[model samples]
Target: MTRVQANLLLLVIALIWGSAFVAQAQGMGVIGPMMFTGIRFLVGALVVAPLAWREWQQLNAQQRAPGRREAGKITALGVLMLMGAAMQQIGIVHTSVTNAGFLTALYVPLVPVLGIFFHRHWPHWSVWPGGLACLVGAFLLSGASSLQIGVGDAWVIASALPWAVHVLMVGRVADKMAAPFCVASGQFFVTGLMALLWALAFEPATLQAVQAAAWPILYTGVMSVGVAFTAQVVAQRYAHAADAAIILSSETVFAALFGYWMMGERLSPSGLAGCSLIFISMTLIQLIPVLKRRYS
Candidate 1:
C-alpha cells in the first residue's frame, strides 16, 4: 500500500484505541483486573477465531507446519502481547486516560531504540533530543510533580517496555508472516487460555461481573480489538511506517477529548503542555525521513 493509505489506517486505529480507554475504565468498575482482561480477550478470541482459523488453514496449506523454532517464536510473541495487555488494563484503573494514552504511546519512540540493540539501526541523532523531550512531556501529562511513581503509572511504564518489545517483534515477523492473522490468532488463543486458567484458579466465574460489564466489554472486545485492529493491519499495508506512528500517536489526543466528553475529566495546563510536547516529539520522529531526504 502507499504511504498515505498506511498512515490513514494508523489514524483510524489510533482513534479506536484512544476511545477504548473509556471502555477499559468502565469495565474495571464491574470486574477485577485479571478477570476483566480475561473476559476481554475471551470476547476478542471468539470474535477473531473464525477468521484467524481460516487464515491459519491457508497458511498451513501454503507452507510447512511450524517447526519448534517457529512455534516457540509465536508463543513468545503471544506471551509478550498478553502481558502488555494485562499491564495496560491494570494501569488504566489507577491512572488518568491522558496518562495511559501518553505512556502507552511511548512505545512509538521506544521501538527505534529497541531496534538498535538488534539491527544496530540507531535512530537519527535528532531522535535522542526528541525522545527526552517526549519523556519529560509524558511526565507532565501524567501529572507527576515528583519522581514518585503510582502503582498504576509504574504498571503502565513497565508495560511500555514489553510493548516496545512487541512492536519490534511484530516488525520483524511482519515481513515473513501474515502478521494480522498470526498476531490476532496467537494473542487471542494465549490470552484466552491464560484467562480461563486464572478464572478457574482465582476468579469465581460469576456472571454478575460479566453481566454488569457487558456493554463495555463488548465494545472493547469487538470494536476496539476486532474492527480497529483489523483496520490498522489493512491501513499499514498502504501507509509509511513513520506516518503510521504519527497517526497512531494521535490516540493521546482522542483519549484526552473522550475523557472530557464522557468522563468529565479535565487536564490541567501543565498536563496539556506535556501532552503537546509529546505530540510534537512524535510528529518530529515521523518527519525525520522526510527531513533527511530533503536536506541530507
Candidate 2:
C-alpha cells in the first residue's frame, strides 16, 4: 500500500480504538485487568488465527521455517504488547482519566527517538515539530491543570516505553518477515497466553465475571484487537513508524468525541483547540513528505 493509504488505515484504527475506550473502561469494573486483557486478546487471536494459517500456506519453504531469531523477536513483541495493555488497564484505575490520556501520548515522540538512538533510523524533520505538537495537544486535550505523579500515573508513564518499543518492533518485524497476518496472530496469541497466566495467578476469574463483561470483551477483542491491530501491522509495512505514531495518537481525539457522544462528556474550549492543533499537526506531518517527494 501507498504511505497515504497506510496512514488512512491507521486513522481508522485510531477511531476504532478510541470508541473502544468505553468498553475497556466498563470492562475493568467487573473483571480483573489481566483477565479482561487476556480474554480479549485471546479472542482476537482466535479471530485472526485462520487468516494466519492462510498466510502460512502461501509462504515459500524458506519463509515457513520460523527462524529462531525471528521467533525471538516476535515473542518479544508479544511481551511488549502485553505489557502495554496490562499497564494501561491497571493504570487508568488509580489515575485521573485526563492523566492517563495525556501520558499515553508520550509514545508519539518516543517512537522516533528510540529509532534514532538505537535503530539508527532518523525520521523526517516534520516529525519532530509535529510530534511535539501532538504531545502538547494531548496534554491540553487531557484537560489536566497540573501534572501529578502517582502510582497510576507512573504505571501509565511506564506503559509508554513498551508501547513505543512495540510500534518500532512491529514495523521492523513486518519488514523482515513480510507476513503481516502471521506477525499479528503470533503476537496476539503470545500476549493472550502470557496475560492469562498472569490473571490466573493473581486475579479471580469466573463465568459470571466474564458474562458481565462479555460485550465489552467481545467488542474490543473483535474490533480493536483483532481487526485494528492486524491492520496496523499491515499498514506499518508502508507507513513510516514515526508518522504512523502521530496518526495513531489521534485516538485520544476520537476518544473525546466518543466520550461526548456516548457518555455525555463535554469538551471545553481548550479541548476543542487541542483537537484542532492535533488535526493540523497530523496534516502537516503527512503532507510534508508528500511535498518533498513531489518537489524534489
Candidate 3:
C-alpha cells in the first residue's frame, strides 16, 4: 500500500475506535464490563474465524510443516492482544471517554519504552520531551485534581501498559504471518475465548441485556474489532512505526469530537488545551527521525 492509502486506513481505524467509546459506555448501562466484553468478543470471533481458518490453510499449503514455534508465536501475540482489548473495555466503563481515549494513546509513546527490554535501544532524545508533554496532557484530559487518580483513570493507565505490550508483540510477530488473516483470526479467537470464560464464570448471559445493547455490541464487535483491527494490522504493515503511532493517536481527537457532538459532553478550555498539546507531542515524536536525518 502507498503511504496515502495506509494513512487513510489508519484514519478509518481511528474513527471506528473513537466511536467505540460510546458503544462501551452504552453497553455498560445494561451489563457489567466483563460481561459486555465477553459477548462483544464472542461476536468478533465469529466474524473473524473464517479469515483465520483460511490463513491457516494457506500456511499449511505453503510449508511442509508450520512448526510449533510459529504457532506458539501467533498464540502469544493473540493472547497479548486479547489482554489489551479486555483491559481497555473494562477501563472505559469506569472512565470518561476523553480519559479513555487519551490514556490509551499513551501506548503510542510507551511502544518505544518497551523496545528497551527486547532490543536494548533507547528512544531518541526528542522522545523524552514529547512523552513528558503527552503525560501532562493525559493528566489534564483525565481531569484529575490534587494528583489524586480516580478508579477510572487508574484502570485506563493500567490498560496502557498491556496496550504497549500488545503493540510490541504485534510489531514482532505481525510480519511473519499473513497480516489480515493473522490479525483477524488471532484477535477474534483469543478475545472470544476469554470473553466466554468470563461470561460463564460471572455473567448470566441475559437476553435482555444483550437485546438492550444490541446496536452497541454489534458496532463494537463487528465494526470496531473486526474491521478496524484488520485495517490497523494491514496499515501498520506499510507504515513506519512512528507514523503508525501518530495515526493511532488521532483516536483521541475523534473520541473527543464524537463525545461532544453525540453525547453533549463539552470539554472545558483546559481539556481542549491538553488535547492539543498531546496531539503536538505525538506529531513531534513522529517527525523527530525525519528532522534528525535532515540535519545530522
Candidate 4:
C-alpha cells in the first residue's frame, strides 16, 4: 500500500477502536469484564481464522513451524493484550466513555517511556515535555481537584502501561514475521483462552448474559479487534511508526465524539482540558522531530 493509503487505513482503524469503546462500555452493563473480554476475543479469533490459515499456507515448512523465539513473543503479546483489555473493560464500568478514551490514549506517550527499561534506551527530549503534558491532562481529566480518582479511571490509566508494551511488542514481532494475519489471530486466540479462564474462575458468566451482550461483543470482535488490528499490521508496513501512532491516537477523539453523540456524555471543563493536553502532547511527539529536521 502507498503511504497515504496506509495512513488512511490507520485512521479508519482508529475510528473503529474509538467507537468501540462505547460498545465496550455498554457491554459491561450486561456482563462482567472477563466474560466480555473472553467472548469478544473468541469472536475475533474466529473472524481472523480464515485469513490466518491463508497466511499459513503461503509459508514454508520451517516458517510454518512455530519457533521458540516467535512462540515466546506471541505469548508475551497475548498476555499484554489480555491485561490491557481486561483493565479497560473493567474500567469502563466505572468511568465515562470519554474518560476511558482519553485515559487509554496515555499509552501513546507511555510507549517511549517504557522503552527505557525494556529496550535500554532513553526517549527523545520532546517526549519528556509531552509526558508532562499528558500527566497534567490526566490529572485534570481524573477530576483530581477533588483529591480522588474514580475506580474505573484509575484502572484505565493503569492499563496504559501494558498497552504501551503491547504496541512495542507488536512492532517487534511484525518486523520478524512475514505473516501478520497469523500472528494477530494467534494472539487473539491466546487472549481469548486466557480471558475465558479468568471468567470461569471469578465471573458468573452465563448464556443469558452473553446473549444480552451479543451485539456489542460481536461489533467489537468483528470490527475493532479483527479488522482494525489486521489493518494496523498491514498499514504499519508502509507507514512510519511515529506517523502511524499519531494517526491512531485520533481514536481518543473519535471515542469522545461517539460517546457524546450516542450516549449524551459530556466531559467536565477539567476533562476537556485533559483531553486537549493529551492530544497536544501526542502531536508534539510526532511533530517535533519533523520541525527539528526541517529547521536544522
Best by lDDT: 2
The residue pairs in collision within model 4 are none
Higher-lDDT candidate of 3 and 4:
4
Model 1 C-alpha lDDT per residue in residues 221-288, reported as the tens digit of each score: 88886777656555655543434444565676677779889999999998799778867876776677
Once all C-alphas are superposed, what RMSD does model 1 give against the true structure? 3.4
TM-score of each: 0.82, 0.95, 0.83, 0.81
lDDT of 4 by residue, 1-296 (tens): 77667767887898999899889888988898888888888899899899888877777555564567876787788899999988987897898765775677677666666666777766568766766676667656655443336999899899988888777667557656877887788888889999999999999877988999999999999999889987787777776554555567667667767888999988788878877876787667667876898999
Best by TM-score: 2
Quantify how close model 3 is to the true structure by its C-alpha RMSD in Å.
3.2
List per-candidate RMSD values in Å: 3.4, 1.5, 3.2, 3.5
Residue 41, model 1: lDDT of 69
- Where's the lowest-lDDT run of ten residues in candidate 3? 140-149
Task: Name the runs in model 4 displaced over 4 angstroms.
Answer: 1-9, 61-65, 87-106, 120-123, 142-158, 235-250
Q: If ranked by lDDT, best first, what sequence of candidates would result?
A: 2, 4, 3, 1
Instruction: Residues 162-209, candidate 3: write the lDDT tens digits.
Output: 767765566446665654666565656666677668777977667887
* Model 4: worst 10 consecutive residues (lDDT sum): 139-148
Residue 157 CA displacement from its true place in model 1, Å:
3.8
lDDT at 218 for candidate 4?
97
